[model samples]
Target: MNFAIRALRKNEQRVAVLFIMTIYPNKVSASTSPFAFIKDYSGIPREQEILFSTHTVFRVGKIKPTFNYNRLCEVHLTLTDDNDPQLAALTHRMRQELCGSTGWHRLGHLMLKVGEYNQAEELYNELLKKASTDSEKAHIYHQLGCVKDEEGEYKDAALFYEKSLEISRKTLPEDDPSLAAIYTNIGGVYHNVGDYSKALEFYEKARQIKEKALTPNDPSCATSYNNIGSAYYHMLEYIKAVEFYENALEIEEKTLPQNHPLLATSYCNMGSVYKDMGDYLKALEFYEKALKISEKALPPNHPDLATFYGNMGQVYHNISDYPKALEFFKKAHQIKEKALSSNHPSWAAFYNNIGSVYEDMGHYPEALKFYEKALETSEKSLPSNHPELANSYGNIDLATSYGNIGLVYNSMGDYSKALEFYEKGLEITKQASPPNYRGLAASYGNIGLLYRHIGDYSKALEFYDKALKIKEKDLPLDDSDLATSYKDIGSVYHDMGDYIAALEALQNAFQIQQQTLDENDFALSPTYCCFGKIYRGLKDYSRALHYFEKCYTIVQQVLSEKDPALAIIYNNIGDIYRLMGDYETALSFHQKALNIQENVECNPLDCATTYTSYGETYREMKDYSTALIYLQKGLHIREKKLPKHHPDLAVIYHNLAKLYLATQQYNIAMENIQQAMDIAQEKLPLNHQHLLDYRETFEKI
Candidate 1:
């Protein structure tokens, strides 16, 4: 066996000599034993042992024929197997002696690798008690820091790493590998604590040291790149994150094996960057590559495989492939449920992901069930005010649970219940340390949506602006969340008859969506619809049809045929046709919308809106009897289902008045016009074009 002493500093040699002295105090004299090698190397006055040869060289220069403690030296000890009882006995004794220090260090490292953090801490702490020098104590402290890091005690881990770093700076050279490693460890602690700026500071320091001291493709240098990428990723700097991730991947591919776990991590990190950038196809490509490597490198039940499956799930969900998303999510959940403890935060995260998929699919009951499960798991696993429960980027897990429940209630047309849950989420988000702006934005947006549905445009705009302000500050320019805020604000403007502001906000959202999202992404559908409606309000029929067609094409590609969203686009297209004097084409499109509504279990409000559009198309064609029938059908449903002051009801009544006027039923026409005028006066702005038009129609009736 040959033991090579490599990368040892000048002071390290003195420490090693002291350690040898402590282990073999009286046995330092020349003898035919392994301990004899230490005596020859230490420059003590002793004769050479006949059984062994020694090689020692001073690093700086040849020393005088005298003991000089200042000179740095390299020592090589070689033991060869021989058919001799004395040699065997000496080898056995050497193993037993070295086991006290080296064995404990190796065992502690193994414990840390296996996630036995408490055991690793105990072993490292025991080693600290026996550590005789600053170098030895630094190594022990570094190991203890690793144990704390693994246990998620980031503050304590950082303290231990700083202590190790302080000692290393004093005892080791400026560009020592140990100093680089300690800097990286401290950076990891800051990264885990959500301090991306602080994390980047330390990570840059580590990278500078590693670049100076290590080769370009060294694994340690790659780790610094990877850590820097992670910090950028958490900061939502996707382009910078991708750049650093590619750098790490370049080094990893050059040095690591094809199936190395580190290569999978590099690919996974790239996938996350693309995912956040709203590039679903690129995200999926990287995620699949990571999954392939993880499957090859890890066991079927490994947590890394679960992560890959979850990442794939997120990609599918983003692209609106509900079935595929559910399939991947369920696979990930199954693996995580079996691999992790029931109350583990990872299990909660998995459940939350599954719930989000269900929510996007409009399966509200299932969404609520999974969201509740996530909350239950979080309650068991996390402390009451755990920071992880409050996400800084916007969606706090605990607040998300409440907000998601509110969304389901809103979808179910239960406005009061939705308000209760949304406010609950809002209050929780406001209590977060530094306040979870992202969560606050989402809660405010939800409240805005509820208010919009209830026809309170002023309150809706207020909340929507609140969401927009937070999102503008927290999100990047092309972020999907920023697009959503703009979309909500635009929709409120449209409802308030502020067509110019609506067009401006919708165009802003469209520009962002075009930059960041796929053409067929479901999130872009609403932006398209809003553009269509704004153009239609401006009487730009050609532009209205163009946007409505875009919305229709996207929904056709992404949604099922029976989706109620299809009916909305159809109705908008019908309205455009009516405005262009193509009444036959208008009625055909409205009937197509009505057919879908009648066939599917659609929302009654949607069915009523389609009926009103159909009535308007028939009245345009001078089909008074048919127009009255459709108008009455729509009015009956709206009167029963909608609030008396709903703007939609006002529009329906206006259509009924026009139908009655076409038939020369002057008294009934005047009565219906009066109702329309009353609702318009109550709900619309004084100078609104709809109110002016309604007043003219009332005088004619």
Candidate 2:
């Protein structure tokens, strides 16, 4: 290395000889041996990559690329002109002079902020290794824990935080604010693991320590309140959570500026509580206010903005405004897509949200497409057992595909197949998720519906009870989800010849739905239909007619007169009139149902049932010839259009046998009777009334 004189003029000896100092990118001064690793690297690209052991200046472009942790220190700080001893002295003197506590802290903070985490960790490691006091060591450990938390190593974090606390306890006073800081950090780890009780214990510990150390007006006191509120909210204690949240807001509002970020967070938390309580309008108001503030203060693509958009989408979805929901979901999705990397879980999460909106809008094709994309993205980003990976699979199962290709086979009337996917979804939901999970309850309700359709009342009841048990304690008892469980169980009881049980179940369901849902809510129609069918089973024709008429009117009001549900409700009304022996009114109502089914798109099986009812009415009038023709027509359709062993088809087989027997066609009666008996015996229990009726008729044959 070249030496520089203090005052050189044309190579004359005008100054005393001096030792020239040099420094490597490793930050090693000439005073220390260069072998020691004074420089560390984060192993990230686009930074100093260490090379040659000497203090040699090299061109920025002429460097060996960094591999692993060895040489990253030189990549970011390429040496430029090591020939000038004074210039070299600037580097060496900086390293030697900046070696105290302030220098260490500043370097550590700078490295962490600039994303040189490995270098920061190395600095912190050195600080801890050379710490001279318990307080210094505790500070180093606490800072290390913050980095570990950021890296998602919660076990390591807990250890560091605990160590920090232990040392602080031995050295610092019991009421020190440092103790509060450690407690807060430990609580964060517990919260991530879903251990809300442990989280709350630590948060309260922190709060107590903070209260002892500082006045009530301290900003840290507000942080404690906010964190406690979050823990309570996770525990589903919304009232207590709201109280704490409001307390936090009060102090923050009193002290912090109106435009501060903490005020936005407080508004969002209050909005979340209102959303959970099903007060969508109120939730929307608060969420919008938070959105306005965040939009003004945060970057457009910030994660907080994405959260605001997603939460707004939820409010719109709750209000049945699918188009508005789609718009907000898209806004969240675009931000997440750009802000997050292609393989990040956040991108996949927003993909799932947008797909769900497609599902709600009856766009099954688009739903399946996006769900597959989400599943693919999630698999690439997360581990195999990630909860969101299962959700992508579940969404595809519910969104129908080409013909019988989609997740749900509802359009194909394959309720049993749909139940299969529902069971799979439930298993994944429970295994990967927490108790009282809404998705699991939704699957249970779905399986219950399949059992009900197959006339298996016992199995149906078991599943419905399972769903309701999960829902009742978690959601409001009057929530739409619980109301569905009540309605399904009531329908099962009505089908099982338990009218009193059906009435009790259906009435409770109707009351809850009426209380919680909009007056024109579509959920009301099913409850009304269940009530009507229960009355009809009890043979209270007048009450049945009243309930059925109410159902029809409401269905038309909500879904329009030409809707398929309206046609189906009309058929139910016709059945009650037929049972009442009001032939003229029964015929009129049946004709209206047939007209709707024939002219408008309706379920083929339901249309066939209308023919079966017409045949039964003709037989009761003793018009044997017309009854035989109509019964044969119903039987033909049921056999061709329905599953081989369908319960509804069995009903048609029984009616056909009865019509033939009345016409004195004994051989034809025997053939149809055997068909009915085989189907009923295979599909239903011996104690079932359908089987009982068919068995007596077969004995006569």
Q: Count the backbone clashes (under 3 Å) in each candidate.
A: 2, 12
lDDT of 2 at 235: 72
Candidate 2 accuracy as lDDT: 0.69
Cα lDDT of model 1 by residue, 188-289, tens digit: 876765567777998999899889888888877888889999998887777788889999999888866666667888899999988877666778889988
lDDT (tens digit, per residue) of candidate 2 on 1-701? 02232234334634333222344554544564433432465364454434455754433333233343221222333444435454454345335423236778768865543335567778899888888988888888987887666544566778899999999999877778879989998998777555667789999999999888888987679889989998998776777889999999898778665555566788888888877755666688889888987775555666667888998987776555667788998898777765545654445456666666665554656765776676566456435444431333333322211211223344345666656556655665566433425666766776777776656668889989998898887776656667778888887876666778889988888787677566545446667778788877777889888878876765564354554556677778878888999877777877788887787645566777888888888888888788777777777877765567767777777887887787788998899888888877776756666788899888876
Candidate 1: clashing residue pairs, number: 2
Segments of candidate 2 deviating more than 4 angstroms: 1-171, 213-219, 341-352, 369-443, 450-457, 469-484, 494-499, 508-701
Give the lDDT of residue 1 in candidate 2. 8
The CA lDDT at 646 in model 1 is 73
Q: What is the lDDT of residue 73 in candidate 2?
A: 22
Worst 10 residues of 1 by lDDT: 57-66
Candidate 1, after superposition: displacement of residue 549 in Å? 2.3
TM-score of each: 0.70, 0.56
* Pairs clashing within candidate 1: 394-438, 394-439
